[model samples]
Target: MRSLAGLAALVAAASVFLYLLSTHLPPGPTRGPPGSAEEEEVEEDGGVQEYRLKFPSDLDELRELAEMLKFYNREHHGYVLLLFCSAYLYKQSFAIPGSSFLNMLAGAIFGPWEGLALACLLTTVGSTFCFLLSSAFGKQHVVQRFPEKVALLQRKVEENRSSLFFFLLFLRFFPMTPNWFLNITCPVLNIPMPIFFSSVFIGLIPYNFICVRTGSMLSEISSLDDIFSWGTLAQLLAIALMALLPGALIKRYGEAHLKVDGVDSNGPSRAEVKPVRERW
Candidate 1:
């Protein structure tokens, strides 16, 4: 109950912060010149609605919101940036889904290079915040709620302990991995904070780059399908495989050197190995 209450309070605080930020923004269509293609598209889609700060769920809504924010970005650049950072961090810290939309939005507003940099930085920082929150308030609840999952992840983490950073990189590279789960459970698995932070920062670059780049061309994209097409999936899979190479080599080396009937041939005995395994 205490954990839940703390989580709720944090969420409420974040919501209030967003509300305050939203209030500071001037009304929609405040700066852009008239009848441009961007303006025409926005007008055809029922004109700029009042700027309400929230997550955009689909392409049309994303386009509308992007257009609205772009208009605001012209005159209130600092506030727009702050609002984007705050919203990105809020979702990231809480493990909320739909960051792809925001990543693209960043691209639409900030352009490709800037948006990519921003996305990568915010993703790392936000995920780290989530890790810290989970460390402080979630370990007990996670273990209790998902005992089997916890045990499985604990075993996997131990198996990759020798090359844990590379293993984490592979997970981050693989698009299918549940990153939120990783963030929440990593502390419970005893992963180091430096490794966690570094992995998240370095590992998510490709994904963030893709989203930001697509966002840079937000005007051209038709749907999320355009972002995660077959070619993109292949690229992500290949990157994930490359990230796994170091870890696989480490595993193979350990097995060759240490696995002689489940004990090192010239070193530790079974009894000694027990202590080493426990030490992990």
Candidate 2:
């Protein structure tokens, strides 16, 4: 009876966690999804219009504006914004349209924390959408249409299921991992959704903050000097360096405590410790 109760509890907890991880973001004007008229990768008019550069001068004012948005958010029981963000991302991955523009627009709607939270949530949900689509289509279908670089992603996911969370983190940090590729193959790899989403939430949080803060800073940025501020680079680099810390620590500690002593070093046995060849 106790064992059954424990099992039931575990299942319920897992279910709840899954529900949270799979949550989506709410939608707003100008944000539809992937393949939507506005979000097309290949716009018939040529390329995406250059993002306009218009930022308010005062950061305090921007901060206050973000706060006001958050205040109004109180009326929703909670997570309504997150839901819209999630849905937008998921829909975008599917070609709903206007996703690119709205990704930036996310800065205006949700401030840093909420935007970061919702972005992380939505990115995971979007990845899952890709995963499902890829699973349905298969890799052969994926490679021929997409670029050569995409195939490598499929191979990595195939070989490295155990370290996928870390790999995903690295990819999200570097901004190199193709979200669509991961989306398509993860389900195919049979990676449990919870592990995938937890990684997404933790990994992409920094990137979301960057976008949100960048949006907030847009007004102040004018000249090239303002555009490439040293302080911003330093902060971003510091965060990036933090990701490498675990690797550095592992190497540093692993080598320091070489398990040599009682077990004997790899060197030849000492004369005292070595027995003379006996004629047994």
Residues 1-280 of candidate 2 have per-residue lDDT tens digits of 4534554564466446535633422322232235544345326545532221122235545444333334334554255454445446545455343433334345655644565566666766776655555554444444444433343454454445556666555555444444545565455446677777776666656555656555544433546787569976775576556555644553354345322122211222233232221111
Listed in order, each prediction's TM-score against the native is 0.74, 0.46
Ten consecutive residues with minimal summed lDDT in candidate 1?
Answer: 259-268
Residue by residue across 1-280, what tens digits does model 1's lDDT show? 8988998899999999888887767655632448656566566667654556667999778888887777778877988899999999999999999889999999898988899899999999999999999888888887776555555556656777887887677667653337888898788888899999999998777778778766776655567896578865665566566556654664565455422232111322334332112112
What lDDT does model 2 reach? 0.48
Q: After superposition, how far is residue 255 of candidate 2 from its true place, in Å?
A: 15
For the record, the alpha-carbon RMSD of candidate 2 to the native fold, in angstroms, is: 17.1
- For model 2, the stretches where C-alpha displacement exceeds 4 angstroms are 1-87, 95-103, 137-140, 143-151, 219-280
Rate residue 113 of model 1 by lDDT: 84
The TM-score that candidate 1 achieves is 0.74
